[model samples]
Target: MNKIFIIEDDVRIREELSTFLNRYGYESLFSINFENIIEEALKEKPSIILLDINLPYFDGYYICREIRKHSDVPIIVVTSRDSDMDELMSINLGADDFITKPYNTQILLARISSILKRVYGVSRGEILEYRGIIYNMAMSEVTFNNNSLELTKNESRILNILINNNGKIVSRDEIMKTLWQEAEFVDDNTLTVNVNRLRRKLEDLGAINYIQTKRGQGYILI
Candidate 1:
């Protein structure tokens, strides 16, 4: 069963969301201690997260950004704020989707399922190995010679696609499309920055020539 972490401070909203998710066969972990939302999320390792914009101690954007530092788990912003700015901000913070308050349960469920399918199901393959480097899609982690390589969310996603399509060129357009599918916008340089950061991490892990950039083409795992 997929685990879902809810980080809403409203007890009523949290319980309602949890119960609704449970009906859809999802195991929900509602956040009680707002001060330790990240700790709980790390401990639970949820498949998806439902976050609210108005949190108690810390805001949802902060939590989402923090989580994106290490994990690429699907996050759906469920909040009362209906502003387009809020939605865009959530996406900018790395949320997979957004749902406003008073949302239809059926629509929410559909969105959740769609995001999960696109994220964890389609983009990922089995554990990928290349040049003694191990990239585990399920765990969203990489290891080299038994030493784990810490990766950010974007780094992990980039490595996941490249390593899974080993020896094949992955178009930059394709990557940008995937990353921006949840939102209407993505900065032109965001993908470039992520690729550079990922390459640096790989180099630090003693892996060279892993990601080869093709001029006027794309990137390939070599």
Candidate 2:
């Protein structure tokens, strides 16, 4: 079952949300210690976070930004403040999605399910090994022959797609589509820059010529 962390100040709303989620087959963890909301949420490490803007000690925006610093867990802002600025701020703070107060339980559940499917629901783990390098998804780094190469988010993602596909070629467009969800946004050159950077990183880790470009085709991990 998917675990959900709820961080709403209103006891009634929190409890109701928990009960609703539980009824829909999700394990719910509520925020009790508002003073240590971030700490507790980190410890819980739910599959997704349901955060309210009107938190006690720190607003959800602050908490969301702090959480983004450590983990990429999907966060959905649940708040009664249904202003355009509030929604914009939520996105600016790295919220995966936003919902207004008096939200329909079904809609909330749908949003949660959609985000999780797009993120954690995918087949990913702490580590992925391809050829000689072990891609640590958690750390966004690849290790080869005892040497570790740290990767930027885009670099890691590009390598991961190629590695995951293995023998088959992975098109640049395909990579862009997959990464657009996590990236701030990218253009054609951004992908080229990331791939070039990834090539250098791989070479540094002794995987020279590992990622091959097929000229007009795409890239393949050999």
Candidate 3:
């Protein structure tokens, strides 16, 4: 499995995406310590990196530049900001690919897959199924009980992540990562709001009470 490094401060995005990537056969590691971001990444020696422009300490561009000086690891910029200048700056700093924040899991996966294939000749793909549900990677959709839910990209991603870890508790941080996507921004508490919405939607679709919250611990699929 190819080791993919992630540099995002949003723990929700970092860990959830890491889980998704891992399920697809890539070893994903997100930076928890930002004190020596570059040093930590270099030490890990990842095949590729998903970098975010807005990081904890030093921004991604500076780190990308520093990394480029030593290694040619493929760097994909994942930024919340959308501007020509930002994209141009990322390219100038030696980033291989750039993606705007709250991106679709399919889009992100495709980018990583493409970059990995080109760089390391390795590709990762997944077709997730649990109970009666299907997570179609190509379409970024969920199919359950022969009924298709054209979910928002984040919803599909959150559902897929949860189902992949079936019978286990997934924290609010994990499920809520989906709400932070797009140009619209939702705060931390909004994760719970989104999960409640997702739960209702799932129930409305004729599914049982699949998700249950465990107070301070997290939510579990029961």
In model 3, which runs have C-alpha deviations exceeding 4 angstroms? 126-222
Output the lDDT of residue 147, model 3. Answer: 64
Which has the greatest TM-score? 3
Cα lDDT, all candidates: 0.80, 0.82, 0.78
Candidate 1 structure quality by residue, lDDT tens digits, 1-222: 888898888888888888977865778997588898888887898888888889888898999999999899889999899899999999999998998888756456656666777676832223556777776555566776556666777788888788768899999888877666743377767888999988887888788778899988889989
Clashes of each: 0, 0, 1
Residue-wise C-alpha lDDT for candidate 2, range 59-120, written one tens digit per residue: 88899999999999999999999999999999998999999978655456556766766786
Provide the lowest-lDDT 10-residue window in model 1. Answer: 122-131
Q: Give the C-alpha lDDT of model 2.
A: 0.82
What TM-score would each prediction reach against the true structure? 0.54, 0.55, 0.58
Model 2 misses residue 187 by how many Å?
54
Off by over 4 Å in 1: 122-222
lDDT of 3: 0.78
